[model samples]
Target: MKNVLNDPVVNVKGIGEKLEQGLNSLGIYTVEDLLFYFPARYDVYEIKPLSELIHDDKVTIEGKVSSEPSLTFYGKRKSRLSFNLQVEHVTVKAVMFNRAFAKKQLQVGDMVTLTGKWDQHRLQITVSNYQKGRAKSDAKIQPIYALKSDVSNIQIKKAVTTALSQYQDDLQEILPEEYLSAYKLPGRLEAVKHMHFPDNHQVLKHARRRFTYEEFLLFQLKMQLLRKRKRESTFGNSQDYQAKDVEKFVEALPFQLTAAQSRSLNEVMTDMRSPYRMNRLLQGDVGSGKTAVAAIALYATITAGKQGALMVPTEILAEQHFQSLQELFADKASVVLLTGSVKGKRRKQVLQEIADKQADIIIGTHALIQEEVVFQDLGLVIVDEQHRFGVEQRRVLRDKGLHPDVLFMTATPIPRTLAITAFGDMDVSVIDEMPSGRKQVETYWVKENMLDRVLQFIQKEVDNGHQAYVVCPLIEESDKLDIQNAVELYQQLQEIYAPKTAVGLMHGRLPADEKEEVMRKFAANDIQVLVSTTVVEVGVNVPNASVMVIYDAERFGLSQLHQLRGRVGRGDAQSYCILVADPKGEVGKERMKIMTETTNGFELSEEDLKLRGPGDFFGKKQSGMPEFRVADMVHDYRALETARTDAQQILASGALDENPVFQKLAQYVYNDKIVKGETLD
Candidate 1:
């Protein structure tokens, strides 16, 4: 069998070095990557001819040009070309924009085909893309790949075809033959070919299913193998904690623990007591008191004479955590903040304290993972917003002073099946309950026309000595969009309410010191209306802020809108969240509906998942998420259940444990870190 990874891009017959560089820019360095690059979408030009085409119908027509193409230039900047096509007795004009080259390609009595909507109201065929000849099949589906400006689908398809032709017969069947036969699926070679050039929709469906399942199954196997390897690794001594210390820490708390929090804490405590090491994830939503629970774990490690590290995402968040931890541990536990911005003698002293174990709890951003920041005896590591931190960073923190019991926390609620699929090997504890006194932020969706009234409401609130947050969707007006910008709005609002109210603008592009200064002013009620971006999504805790107005809310995802809503309603006063929407299209209307229907972050997250899949859930380029082509997280949830059950059965039966095929599968999963003759971790 030919190894696809070893086949070079240039080794494919027709590709040259210059073209290879362009392909490499798209991350297609080898034949395997090329084959794995699935099509983003398929355009099926499966419609009747223009003669049979109805008004307002999307049709594909095959005809010959009946007239010479003519171009009309409105000066040197703008121009349009027109041509008439004769399909039987009917003649329809085809228009081209700025394509004078296309005008030359069309001659009288030349064959041409166009696929687009026949808009009778405009009396035009709004062509998306034109072809030189009619499609071979009257009804045909053409594959379209995700391409950049430098590349196109035709070039990708040709390159892929060449690569496949060289290795189609020799590609390995990764799955066992018995299972492959049972499922009635084709071999890897056939599947890859069909994915690129399928004869029919049914064939394409099967090919996609096989490829997506393979991707997902390999991901699951990799995670399983990593878990096994990590669990089997050696660990240093684990410190035992005093029950009285934990009790004292809890008793001194300002509020009582929710039942969910208490349960999650107990789970952490048990994990800390384990001999090997602990790697647990504490999943919770906003205002679920996860930080307080983490404090308990930190306290336990301290009581055992070991230090813990709390790594957050941003400097703003790290500082907030540092202050809160200092207040909680006052004179009881030593805590210090470490970040990149910390300077001179203060940074040296903090580093010294952490190195000497004088500081029991060290809070910081990525600075905590630095080599110089050695631990005297690092026992536990608690990572907040675990997804925000890269895998290498987490591994570095894990490698610091033996295998510390790692606890990851995130406010974003991941669905249970996805959690199991993503973090299947790790133990998960979810705090589904919200803490008491967290008032539901009253949310309302308003049209663009109603924005003036919303501004009036904000003015009234600011007049009452309460602070307000006005978030713009963009930093500047985008040439392609009509969304409001923070800079423009800041100027307008300043003109409207300048002398009476102070207005400030904050965005991610701002300098760190400037952002901190603006936030400080807003927190202190100095800036009556803080005009900003989504930068204040999770960091601050302002008690008196009573209003949040989000402009162009339809442009944001449901979870994001909810996060902005969370900015308000932190205090005792009645808080309000106003979402400004254009209400022009279905997407805008749906976005507004999602904001008004519910206040629960979990529900919003589910809706967001339904709207947009896990394609970019973690970020733009994500790893380890099982991309099931058939199993939709929204509609095909039943398929996910089936897959989960199938995995369980395979694990439970001695077949996977004893069979040679299964053994080979497991070894492939952990090839880099394979241990000698082990059935289980």
Candidate 2:
């Protein structure tokens, strides 16, 4: 029988029923998962004595309790346990919150080590988990595991220790030994063990470097495979068409296309006309002519006796795209809108038309991917805000056509290093320049006390027949915050500006129809002041909306703030984005400074990445992206570069198809579970 340490969590001793349930809540169903649970930080408990510690010093101290412990309870709910410790003749107070057990364990003259900052007001040692040890003269770091509410760091550390002792020999190195040595990466098992419990700061850094590179390499390998698959598949109806019709469509537009837009359209058209299908990304800042470029592609398809589909992130965006496409392609082709809201006969008929090739241009949200929806000859598939959809959704849409040429679009500018690392397979085309006559929106930062003046500015803009968007950071009340809720803010704004203008509220919590209704009213100018959350960040396109008031602007990422600002300045009218910051600290002020300094989405995105690091998930504020604990995208750009270079070199060598090692690495990255089934074939 396998030892308890080598078996799964279910087989662990003393974790039979109740404890197993507690462990399950912490996502530790398997012993392997528990082993992979890494630390978030470490409280180094090795420091000099209190006498050696100076004023305003942050250090760890080891000493023995010299005085009787004191227990004090204030305000019924608040209780503090304190004791005096003698560290080289300098007495320091050890404090803990609601820790009654500490009073018994830490007797007078008992040895204890305390770690924290020391100040004039009571040698404050916030007692970081007392342990009996001599103070280390050398600097040391300890592992601090990220724990679920129910699971403590000690529990995870103990499990990790057990797993490391048992499974140290079982972990086979998946990467080639030569590659590992060349890159100076740790052994797979060694890295995993150190990641969970590092002995020193250098070991932790090295372990992190190894793990991050592994992640990037694995991700790149999978993307390369997918790219190969896409290229091999014969998709996209390469229908023949005249450039004259595309020119006519461009001519009919009220505004001329920017040079960047024209260049991107040319590249897309060249791809569309090619025998191989196009899978390109149309990335641009807000107010750039990407939409117009997309129109050109759709019209080119229609002229060539093929169909085109535009999948947007939200229903409001879908409706807006449908309306704009219809107006632009009224004389040339038939355009249809299909969303979940379209019911009964209308939905069925639209689906039929899509499948039958009667609809030349189809615009909708995720409803376009319904199994019933088909394209007669889907020549092109444009996914606006492409990151909003998962990889599977992109595949599903690709499967809909022979291999519809995909044009993924995003307004959120990403850093160049991340773009190359994250989007290695897909060909990228950037529309970096905005159209002429688009006056850059003037940005300002104001404190909460100056909100009234900002409101007055918004009212002035509204009075000029332009609309305004008021963005709130919170949708509802939370126990941790005293910030204003969106609903409350909407009501307050309605009361304040009621007689002069109509107020509309839109948020993710509202039913789709209600949100759409509010958005439609605002877009139509029936509601002059639209109060909303970040729900309006990507969904709506109202050129008439000229002013944006972002409440608690400091709460947002710089990239997100740029996106919110993009909501305005859509029309020719001059626009303004007022960032109202909390007066708490320089954090808010610094964020506002970044916003006021630039309007470049790419620059702002780099700054955002520099500030908050990498996010696991993104799209609408409603979507929750998974957070990666150890990986830092901005700081770890070197790792990304290393992985990309190695992947490219390997691919360039053309060994993946023939070499056994690459076959194993491919399977390792793709299946992730295939490692167990490995056998000498």
Candidate 3:
């Protein structure tokens, strides 16, 4: 049985090479994998007499076949097997379409059990499934699994049944018996069996809860272990907190720091001073002073005789940060920008200064992590728009220094549940409070036909000496159509307000220098109307830009639309975000309505998570969220919290190292973390 569990799925009785390949598409490779392939849902049917069946009531009825089943044609291509089923004094018509074979299987006076929906209007049972026996007294809950096109639920259920019958006893229990009893959870074997074929809803619920807890527990344990490994490692460089320097920097700022900003800065300061490296996530809403908070941390790093590198996702943002930091530092610390556009002697000079520690603050895009660009005494690394970069890229920058204090900044406000699960390894500080004088961007959901009105409104705003942005969705990978869309929109806007206002165009297809130039024009108000794609979703800050017209807003996620809207409302001017979308579905309309109703990013994020699920909420490509087999971050938040607490308790009890079962489980989780490049040691 143990060997059978470990064998390839093709070794199962009915699963041949072709069927095994089909199962493999669903991530089933071995017998053990097949055994754990949980069902997406269940079809529960109760055994009932024909007389008790009503319209749309799914049930199983056992009776004698009073009439011989006959195959008959209805339409040009439709055929069905018809017969009369009798239960005492009640007789019901039974119909099975496209089932000529059933005619040969069943005869008059034969006993049969038919499972289907009862249509009272027709006084018939539309047979979905059948068997040659009396219906069981107990209700049958059949597991319905998600499968590939060629693989049916019946095929998977049969395979699982065979595998379970042979090797259910060999399934190892990862959770200790003590904890199982303490949690009042069933054993692994019993849970697996009941999960696939439960006797009742109660058993099914218990099985689901047990497995959900296991999934969440394993993830939480992995994160905790990773955190523990990092804490124990002595490779980090300890830095002086430099409270005086931080205070001096804050005093130099033009505006006052909000309470949330100050608290977040204090958190960063404390983390930097610790012996262990600072791995923190700084989450703040759009227009929040996260940049200012990061600037303070960088100031402290420079004051402590260390170089600070701020990595943004775009060249325009890097330049913006460079200019802002340069002015803020004002000859106190030498700050330089190193982007792909900075070339020849200029690039070499910047690189030399950075490497020689002459440049106290260096701001750049992905160019900062290149082989040639080196940092001297790099103590602090601030990653703006952290989700844009991959884990390896972030790691490479962190490795530039010996245990650099990494502070990741995201303008996208994450729900608490997501923050805990997705970024469990890092310490998090949220600047939930926006700085004073920041105005909430007024949002409106407009139909596509209202484009002219929106454009006119934008023109009026531009005429009032305020800038505006027109954002379009990326339609194609080649970007031929997307670029053309932006270009066409730019021309259209130019023609509409041509002699009165200047317009610029930007897209992913443009060169780095051109993109920077366009953004520069927009910032300087040289371009009153800038037509672009999601490229302006982050870091193109212009206080004068008071209006944002998002074309095809239905194509964007709520968080993304929020981020684009964030590009505006930086100034005290009453900003407007006009969403011009003709959504085709309820979800999309609901997203638009939510945006129109509120300007709170956190609230919008919660709604987004519920509406779009986690995959689309954070963007599946770069969200870096763990793929859970059973645990859902949104719906199963309670389970996640419980699992987290239990994991901590288990770790504190030293059971992970003392018990062989827990040790194996920890090892498995650790190995999985390694695969994701999340291991600390």
Candidate 4:
């Protein structure tokens, strides 16, 4: 069994070099991988009489070929094999597309089983799969695996069968033996075999339940351990702030805090004052006043005679937060910005203030996480756009203090399912509603043919003494994706609005200082129009930029489109977001409709998560989310809760340390290295 697990997938028959590469693409490396690579779904074939078949019903029917199969070559690599099959003494027309090889297997009197959609009106069957002779008993339930262009599902099924047959008897069980018996789960090898080749629906369901519980248990064990450790490990100072003091400060604010903001702020304060270290996620939409709640928490932390740090994704955002805090706490706390750009003697002074506990509130970029920047008595840490920073980066900043209360803030409203799985160890607080009297951005979907009109509208907005932003999907043209790129669109817009009003260009490829310079120019309205990519998606407040035109908007997800739209409507003046694209598919059209209909970021995020499946999930940087192969955080949430309870009980029972099987499991969990609330704020 050990050798089988270590041996390469090529040990299985028919998995040649090319198929090996395909399996590698799917992250399948060894024969053991083949055994564990379960099917995405199964097509259960129930043989039915032809007379009882309904319209478009997919089923298997036993029949004899009454006529010789005639093959016809159609347009461009297309072929159709048509034959008359006598099923239950009735002749039915059966046609198979692209499976020209079926013609060679069919004879006048040969019996076969065909599974396909039966078109009642056409009195014909569209066969998807067929067996030359009577269908094998085990073939009633066929495993269908996700495939790449290089390999087919049939090929993968055969390989999995070979590996399972070779190592079924010797497969090792990872879950504790008591768990198997208590949960009424099959043995590890039996479960794996059932997952790969389910004999019946009941067995398949049991197999799936076993794996789902297995994954959720592992994930929840890690989360529960983190939670347990946090509760037990108390801070020496044990963050303290008077409730009345926080409430009085809130009352003294110049502007009224939104109800949502107020509620989230209270939640943060409660967590901060708790005996255990606070690990929490603060979620709000773009322009939802998350900064206010964060500022209030920072106030409470500082008032408690401890330092507070606010870290953001970009230097501009850090500067913005720094300015806000500086203004809000003008006569209250000493605020300082310690970005990478703050250099020489000034940087030294900032470091001195931080070390000497003079800077009550220090805001900066990733520079705050540097080894030299030490917090005198850091009690509360607020990380804005938490998804931007990595796990180790956040850990470094938190480690600077003696188990400080960490509050993660994000303008991007993460889908609830993602939030649960991604930050299972942390408590979540959401600011769903925007502040009252905030102007909503009026979104419009403009087709490709209406480009001139959209450009004219932007030109009109610019003429009316307002700046505009044009965002593209790509920075440059690519051979693979033929879309409107930032540089090309910039050049075109520059040519159109040039010599009169300046049109500046910016993208991710630009240097940090150069990008900052362009942004500053655009923010100051020195540049009437700024053409850029989604680099401007994050918090780069430009209230003066009233018009946002997104090219190829359909190429982006709903959440992204909403974020970009948020750039406008920050000021009081009416704002507009014009999406310029033509989507051919219904999903893309629905996305466009959602955008044009509403400006709620959270609603759009849920829709976006549903639309983009596990393939794209959220985005490229979302690797921090739990990568469960079988368990779904969305659909299997109840199972996840059960697993969490079971994990907590097991931990409390000391099984991880006392039981031999659990000892091995503990080692495996440690190797998995599931960190606490790193991303998905």
Best by TM-score: 3
Worst 10 residues of 2 by lDDT: 672-681
Candidate 4 — which residues are off by over 4 angstroms?
1-35, 43-139, 144-193, 230-234, 394-402, 614-617, 645-681
Give per-residue CA lDDT, model 1, range 1-681, as digits (tens).
Answer: 335555777778888888788788888888777777778777778646554667876667778888999988887767788888887677777777777778778889888888777866555676666788776674557778877747778889898888788767656677677756776778788888888888888888887666555545555555554565565573544669888989988998999999999999999998888665777889887778899999999999999989998988777678888998999989989999998889999999999998888899999987888988988888888988644445677667666635678888977777665676667667789898888888878889887899789989999998887889999878887999887899999999999888999998999899878988888888888898999988888667787899999998877888778777877887788999998877777866886888888887777777777776665355545654645543455554554454455555555575455877776455445453423324322
Pitting candidate 1 against candidate 4, the one with the higher lDDT is: 4
Kindly list the per-residue Cα lDDT of model 4 for residues 497-593, writing each as its tens digit: 8898899998889999999889878878899999989988874788888999999998998888888898898887899999998998899999999
lDDT of 3 by residue, 42-127 (tens): 87666655567677977777789999888998877778989998876678899998887788889888889888888888778899
TM-score of every candidate relative to the true structure: 0.79, 0.80, 0.85, 0.80
Q: On lDDT, who's better, 2 or 3?
A: 3
The 0-to-1 C-alpha lDDT of every candidate, in the order given, reads 0.78, 0.77, 0.83, 0.83
* Model 3 misplaced stretches (Cα beyond 4 Å): 1-7, 10-22, 46-97, 100-139, 149-151, 386-391, 394-401, 474-488, 621-623, 659-664, 670-681
In Å, residue 385's CA in model 1 sits off its true spot by 2.2
lDDT of 2 by residue, 1-681 (tens): 232333567664344566567777877777666666677777666565455666665567777888898888887677789888887777777787777667777788788766666665766677545665566565456677665556666666676776667666656566777788897888878888777767787888888888788777776665565565556566444658678877877898899888888889889998888776787877889878888899888888888888888888778778888888788777688899998889999998998898888888999988888788877878788888744556577667656535777888989887876676556667678898988767999999887899889889889988899999999888887678777779999889988998888988888899888988888788789999988888888778899999999988878889889999999998889999998887466655676898999998888888777766655224333222223446665788787777777877777687665678776576566554322223200
Q: TM-score rank, highest first? A: 3, 2, 4, 1
